[model samples]
Target: MGRSRGGYSTKIHVSVDGLGNPLELRITGGEKSDITQGEELIEGWQRKDTKVIGDKGYDADKLIEKIGEAQAVIPPKRNRKTQRHYDKHLYKERHLIECFFHKLKQYRHLFSRFDKLARNFLSFLYLVSALFWLK
Candidate 1:
C-alpha cells in the first residue's frame, strides 16, 4: 500500500487475454507508475503475433522494444516529440480491459479495499479472476 492524501492505497495491474479474461495480475504501491510493472506483466509471454495494446501511460521506448515481435499498439503521450501511428481499430479493443475493471469493482470488498494486506487482496483477485474464467 502507498500513502497519499486520501490514505493508504494500492494499484492493481492486470493483463488480459484477447477475450478479456485475465492472464496475469500484480499489485503495486498506488504511487507507482504503470510503466514500472509493464515488463513483468509480459515477461514470459511467448506470443509473437499478438498486438500489445495499452493506454498512453504504458508508452515508453524500453517497453516498445521489449514487446519485440509483438506489435505495440500503445498510443504516444501528448508531450512526445514524435507522434507514432498505431492501429486505431486495434486500440479500440482496450475498452475490454476497462470493462474488466468495471466488473472487478462491482465486488464491494475489492472496491472498498477492505483487505489491508496486499497478499490477501491479491489472493481475492486471483479468486475473482478464476471466477471470471469459469464463466
Candidate 2:
C-alpha cells in the first residue's frame, strides 16, 4: 500500500492473454510506476509470434528490448524525439484488459480493499483470477 492524499492505496498490475484471460498479476504500492513492474509481468514471455500490446506507460528502451522477438504494439510517447509506429488495430485490443479490470472491480470486497494484509489481498486476487478461468 502507498500513502497518498486520499489515503493508502495499492496498484494491481496484470498481464492478459490474447483472449483477455489473465496470465499474471502483481500488486505494488500506488506510488510505483508501471514501467518498474512491466519487465516482471513480461518475464518468460518469449513467444516470437506473440504480440505484446501496452499503453504508452510501458514504452521504454529496456523493456522493448526485453520483449525481443515478440511484436510490441506499444505506441511511443509524444515527448519521444523519434516516434515509433504501432499497429492501431491491435492496440485496440488493449480494451480487453480494461474490461477485465471492470469485471474485477464488480467484486465489492476487491474494489473496497477489505483485506489489510497485502498477502491476503493477493491471495484473494488469485482466487478471483481462478474463478474467471473457471467461468
Candidate 3:
C-alpha cells in the first residue's frame, strides 16, 4: 500500500505511441519509484527511431543510459547538478498521454479502486482502454 498526504493511492504507469495510443500499462503502489518500471515499459516495443519521453519522475542514470541509447526526451530532475538536454517541443506532446489518463478517469468505476483485487481492476482497465481505442 502506498500512502501520502492524500492517503493511499496507486500509480498507473503507461507507455504510449506518438499518436497518444496506449501501448502498455502497469500499476504500482504510489510509493513505488517510477524508474523501477521504466525499462520494462519499453522492452520489446523499442525501435531504432523510438524516442521515449517522460516526466522528471522518470529521471535516473540507468534509465537515461538505457533509453538514451535509442532516443530519450526525458528532462533531468531540477536537483541534478548536470542538467540534460531535451527537446521541449517533443516533450509537449506528453500531454497526449496525460489526456488519455484523464479520459480513463471519466468512467466512474475507474475513478476509484472499487475492485479490491488487482486482477479485477486491471481487467476493467483493459475494457476501458478498448473503449477508448474504439472511440
Query: Which regions of candidate 3 are displaced past 4 Å?
Result: 1-7
TM-score of model 3 (CA atoms) = 0.90
| lDDT for position 73 in model 2 | 92
Model 3 CA lDDT for position 56: 90
Q: Is candidate 1 or candidate 3 better by lDDT?
A: 1
lDDT of each: 0.90, 0.91, 0.82
Write the residue-wise lDDT of candidate 3 on 67-110 in tens digits.
74577888999999999888999898899889989888898887
Backbone clash count, each prediction separately? 0, 0, 0
Q: How many clashes does the backbone of model 3 have?
A: 0
lDDT per residue for candidate 1 within 31-88, as digits (tens), equals 9999999998887663688788889989999998898888889999999998999999
- True lDDT of residue 117, candidate 1: 86
TM-score of each: 0.95, 0.95, 0.90
* Candidates 1 and 2 compared by lDDT, better number: 2
